[model samples]
Target: MKWHHVQDNWPAFFEAILDRWPDADEAELEEIDGDQRAFIAYVIELTGQEPEEARADIREWLSGELPSDVVMDPRHDNHSIALSKKYVPEGEDEYDDDSRFGDEE
Candidate 1:
């Protein structure tokens, strides 16, 4: 299908889903709407920028602004702490299992 056709028919998405499950709560509907808007806005934003500019801007923004720490829910067995320890170690690749590399070749 053409791009314009897909864009034009986008509004029908809400009706089709809602028609299937009309009893969905207000919060659920709002979430669906918010996701749709965010996706569409992302597509629009990225459509025109050059790849280099987009990548550099995104990298700079993420590196300079995003926090290194995250708040974890203490209810869980602190899975976040465990995952972070493995993925983002105090030293690089500390938790990585290098044994898998020998099998790949």
Candidate 2:
């Protein structure tokens, strides 16, 4: 997906991806989701955070750079969860490369 799509759908998309793997980062995600981490990075960009901000946050928290309470707060504005259910319809094509979405290239 394009970065514009990620900007529009960041909240929901990120939430879904993170829910599947709360500790995921670009490299780890690249193995699991292929090119789709571009979308995840795009979501972080839309937040005005760096590509690795989320991953760094996870790492720092794990290393005690930040308090556990700060890290574990559910109130953190992960917009992905809220937007996820609305952007793509049930059974709709999400993968730009999906044969179901027609030939992408």
Candidate 3:
């Protein structure tokens, strides 16, 4: 599938599940975790979509023609703005130079 090429470009993404169902919070997503029935049920519960319609939506989402706006890099995604506070400022070392890694000294 053409998606093979897309996957080759972004090894980290198996699906843009979050992008498609942003209302599905992280915890629920973790629980669903590729279980088709669970996902379908959740979709129906949240959106009142028919079972067949939900299945079709999933198929289209996983198809070769992936959406262009789904971000592969979290740093560039809109959600990144909320995470910026955790980022270390430029010209500042997050770890001491003498430390082998960032392990607590």
Candidate 4:
């Protein structure tokens, strides 16, 4: 499947990928230009796991069995964040006045 498809179907796994390669320097992690083998290799290095183990782990995580200790970075999980914001009740401000959201005043 395409990378975006994978990201949509397996968001946690995508989040893990983005956690490893932040968008600050790499703009588009979704548009990774290569074969699955290369991507698998990258995943192995990123997660510090054996090839077979990493693949199996990723599969499990994608299937909604994410480990309790696997914390997803908000900076990378934009889809989930956006969804939360979209569904948040009116008058309930979840975010602080951070520069990341632009001018506070």
Candidate 5:
């Protein structure tokens, strides 16, 4: 989905995946978080799809028939780096980056 769509629906999407894989351990949960972020980045950078189209794509991908493996190699891809940078707020401490998402300090 688009960046905003993913940002808005991330909690639901994350919960759904967790429900599907209730046996996931701590490391698996961390991997899931990374995968979800990578999926958001992929949809924004590669597809350029609007919210509806991106949501449909996400639903299809989450259907379990295909792998949900999104390559998150931002270090090598300028487009990925640009997309990621768009979410980084200016004048924010790198360690406090969660504030961009409205997390409290």
Candidate 6:
């Protein structure tokens, strides 16, 4: 995957940019829209990184596969959650201690 990969699916991959730059505001990121020059400039503005380093980092960031954890859509999110539903009973809060799972019949 590259910049074009993200450009083609902005909403799906937008979280990816956030993963890299958690300090970045989502609103500001939306304005970037995956343009290479714009992203590098934004990163530079955000992190104060030199332009050369920012360019390299952005390239590296965009080169990898979209993580499995990325929820591309609500339907895809269901598929990922389906595999975990057995261990985590429906409607159980995620923060709750799941240690009781082993005690179940």
In terms of lDDT, the best-performing candidate is 6
Q: In candidate 5, how many Å is residue 27 off?
A: 20
Runs of candidate 3 with Cα error greater than 4 angstroms are: 1-15, 65-105
lDDT of 3: 0.60
Please list the Cα RMSD from the true structure of every candidate, rounded to 1 decimal place: 16.1, 17.1, 10.6, 10.1, 14.2, 8.6
Worst 10 residues of 6 by lDDT: 96-105
The C-alpha stretches of model 4 lying farther than 4 A from their native spots are 1-4, 7-16, 19-35, 65-105
Stretches of candidate 1 off by over 4 Å are: 1-47, 67-69, 73-105
Off by over 4 Å in 2: 19-21, 24-105
For all candidates in order, the CA lDDT equals 0.42, 0.45, 0.60, 0.53, 0.50, 0.74
1-105: candidate 2 lDDT, tens digit per residue: 333333444343444456544555545444434344554464465445676785564334334222222223354324434445467778754432445546553
Residue-level lDDT tens digits of model 4 in 1-105 = 234445344433455556544431233344444345656676676668898987875565456534333445665465455667866778865453456657663
Number of clashing pairs per prediction, in order: 0, 4, 0, 0, 0, 0
Q: Kindly give the stretch of ten consecutive residues in candidate 5 with the minimal lDDT sum.
A: 64-73
Model 1 scores what on Cα lDDT? 0.42
Minimal lDDT window, size 10, model 3: 5-14
**Which scores higher on lDDT, 5 or 6?**
6
lDDT of 4: 0.53
Clashes of 5: 0
TM-score, prediction 1: 0.23
| Candidate maximizing TM-score | 6
> Arrange candidates by lDDT, highest first: which order?
6, 3, 4, 5, 2, 1
TM of each candidate vs. truth: 0.23, 0.21, 0.46, 0.35, 0.27, 0.59
